[model samples]
Target: MPLAKDRNTLRRDGVQFSDPVAADTLIFAGALVCLDASGNAVPGATSTTLKARGVAQEQVDNTGGAAGDLSVESRRGVFQFANSTSTDQITRADIGSECYIVDDQTVAKTSATNTRSVAGVIRDVDSNGVWVEI
Candidate 1:
């Protein structure tokens, strides 16, 4: 399975993806999205067994649907989100460091005692919020 003569390889931008939504999940537009332990899409939160994926592209209501019944569209990139708290705040000094998820719209400097999942790397901090590369 080696000698292939110019295979037409399929390509994707890798910036966007659609993932099956978890049961009872309602991911809002522009919310930080993550994959749960079962690889289902859910709103990012301060919980373990979650992996930050990207920002939700649009609101997807799956509150009554089971897993895989609906999917959410998300895009990976640097996005600004609300900072956490004084104790968990992300600062300019923390640039390029990993940030933790406080909720779909907030990120913290720590992992909330390792209960939170890694949201993304801190790209920049501003008066408005922290820019995270998800």
Candidate 2:
């Protein structure tokens, strides 16, 4: 047979118990925590402790510009877009000095006037290269 013991009898002022009991035995300990009036953590309270398990932060790229038809030239050259007509061209230098466009589809540049679009998500970046989820 098993019996329930009072919390005060099991634990003294600041002492805990360390004993083995039968598999079917059961013991109930007092509630672990006390709450504040505003439902916030209270100081100098030792009932329950909160800890952060894991944390993660992400960097998002949100460079916005007017969507236009563009073309790629050379092997590692920047991007160029047509203004109004196909004959009128706008170079990357015309946009901004620090503006850089990346081709999301193909890793290798094939043609001088290749017209294409890429659809994917940036996976990660490192010293070697960038990884894309395509």
Candidate 3:
């Protein structure tokens, strides 16, 4: 069964699992990251770049003498992903709107000017941010 808003801790909070490793440098907390061709996580880049993956749950640095792959908590399934809005500015109507990957940590509500890859949908909106459900 699907979890309700109140009971959907995994949905609203994050139903995460540590799987993919960082493609290169370490990623910071709350950064909207994406997957590389190798299935490694990298900061969400432009539409012409990386594919939208998920919001990082925490930071991980596996480089610089670390011989192990850095793990990240990727939110899979239905979950809320918070991200900064682009220059377009977000509004309540943007809620339930389809957003696209703008940058490493940002999403845009409009694709009229840019034909970026679809990241997810804006399920909720705030002053300058939106909750995307991927």
lDDT leader: 1
Say which prediction, candidate 1 or candidate 2, comes out ahead on lDDT: 1
Q: List, residue by residue over 1-134, the lDDT tens digit for candidate 2.
A: 55577555464432222222112212222111111233321111212222111111111111231111111111112222112212222232223212111221122111124332221223433333333222
Where is model 3 more than 4 Å wrong at Cα? 1-14, 64-68, 76-87, 112-115
Give the per-residue lDDT of model 3 (tens digit) for 59-122: 8765652322677786644334445444566677777777877675667766636766677777
Candidates, ranked, lDDT: 1, 3, 2
* Local accuracy of candidate 1 as per-residue lDDT tens digits, 1-134: 89559888899999999999999889999999999999999998889889999999999999999999999999999999999887898899999999999899999999877899899999999999999999
TM-score of 3: 0.65
Give residue 20's error in model 1 in angstroms: 0.4
| Predicted candidate 2, C-alpha RMSD | 28.0
Which number leads on TM-score? 1
Q: Alpha-carbon error at 53 in model 3, in Å?
A: 2.8
What C-alpha lDDT do the candidate models reach, one value each?
0.94, 0.22, 0.66
Task: Tell me the lDDT of model 1 at 34.
Answer: 97
Question: Each model's TM-score, in the order given?
Answer: 0.97, 0.16, 0.65
